[model samples]
Target: MDTELGYSIIPLAILGGAIRVSTPFLFVSLGEALTERSGRINLGLEGTLVFGAMSGYAVAYLTNSPWLGVGAAMICGALFGLIHGVICSLPRVNDIAVGIAMMILGMGLAFYFGKPYVQPVAPDLPAIGFGWWSDIPQVRAALEVNVLFLIGAVLAVVLWWMLRSTRIGLILRVVGDSTDAARAMGLRPAVVRTCATAVGGAFAGVGGAYLSLYYPGSWNEGISSGQGLMAVALVIFARWNPLACFGAALLFGGAGALGPVLQSVGISEGYYLFFAAPYVLTLGVLIATSSPTRAMTGAPGELSITK
Candidate 1:
């Protein structure tokens, strides 16, 4: 009976964790996908993510409204993206280098401003309990989905459609594929990329808000745990596709939840090792997708990393 119980909980626990944990990744990857598809990259999303978490938590604590916090975080993230876009637009400027600098600046600002709210209890975002019909407690817990995750899932589909069927999407794709062609058609690549980057930043910020306003709901310095950085590699692995980003985010979330899920099922012997699964998975993804002689399968041609 005990063995059977363990077997049942493992899958349930993993499913729950995947749904809860993948929300941030889904948002970040979607944001990155949009930016990259517009012929630009914003590595500073790490900082944006962190700052968003901080600001989100702080605002939630102060305003007593979790949704307001999310809004604040999105605004902040957009500003960061805008700054990155504007700076990288200047002649001879390297977006990657500027991104790194922006990352440092964002982290610094978040740390400095977030100190006061570290201990405050903020109102958490509500979850939609899908397991309401279940008699088992674990089943209900496992099925408690955050609204943001559902929104992200829907968003992936919407973005997938937009990118293929919309004129705006066509212009963005054209800009990403060739700046010269964009210029020939009276389109401004720099302006388009800047806007795309800002929108992407807003997405990352919402991911951060998810971290603080929902799961692990709180403000802290180490709250992000490099999820922001991992997002960059995830975009590559997804081939810059928004729908693929959703699937990849779930895969990553499942890997991340393995250690905790195992412990819940009384298999804690190699606890630390299990925790390393996500990073290992990330490394494997990068190695498998990288090439010395050619660009990624579906990468934007104007992306610097490919060139």
Candidate 2:
């Protein structure tokens, strides 16, 4: 029986699954990239992701509109970011400690508020049927790409362009590179970082909406599965570049799908080990990048150091 099911793992299946699973990762990493670009690091997005999932699921249940749910989730995520930004802006506060606290608060609130929506069916996000030209059912099924994924892809390109070309981007770059320089240029670093963090949160919310409103398509306590936390490491690997973040998201997504794909191909001898691929990959990346003597390459100066 398992062998018959395993026969279906192929390039088409892996590609489709990679796109589907990577959507959330892409969004979260992009959000964090933006935050870090503004000289701030927000580790609390894990809570925001879960909160957005819960909030999005609940709002969709109530309004019968998945988009509205997305909006609600964005709002929820923004609030968390705003809180983080505002608190961090105050003197003598540690951003990392605050992030940990915010994450705990967000998770607690999400679990409490999300309990009612778990059993209810929320509307699913619509998908574009790109598989129509394919003759094979498996190929067709694999090509049913979700609209949010396309949006995130486009967003990655746009973000990359904006960060490199726009005036606002220059201001952000200055702020991230040096608070004193921003002040010299009559720019307010706190304001820029706060806005950046809030916007970043909104993007993370959309990722959460993708979770509950599309893939998996349900509200549950375990819906997030550590994607948010993993995004922080992904941002590091991507060098805070939005385009790189997009590529890294796909890589992580592909890594995550390895287990399921192997099982589909009747390779059940080490089914459980395949599931460990993503985590193992993440650990390897962290280990490879670990250097105590110098700062991680490409890190924003203001974020990695107070001076």
Which candidate has the highest TM-score of all?
Answer: 1
What residue pairs are clashing in model 2?
6-264, 6-266
Task: List runs of model 2 lying over 4 Å from the truth.
Answer: 1-8, 283-295, 305-307
Worst 10 residues of 1 by lDDT: 1-10
Q: After aligning candidate 2 to the native by TM-score, how far in Å is the CA of 222 from where it should be?
A: 0.5
Q: Where does candidate 1 clash, by residue pair?
A: none
Q: lDDT of all predictions, in order shown?
A: 0.91, 0.88
lDDT of 1 by residue, 153-176 (tens): 999999988889999889989999
Clashes of each: 0, 2
Q: Against the hidden reference, what TM-scores do the models get?
A: 0.95, 0.93
lDDT of 2 by residue, 1-307 (tens): 1223335556666687788899989999999999999999999999999999999999998999999999999999999999999999999888889888988888899999998898999889999989889666777777889999999999999999889999988898999998999999999999999999999888898899899999988989899988899987789888899999998898788887788777666777987888888778877877786788644776788985434
The TM-score, computed over Cα atoms with residue i paired to residue i, of candidate 2 is 0.93
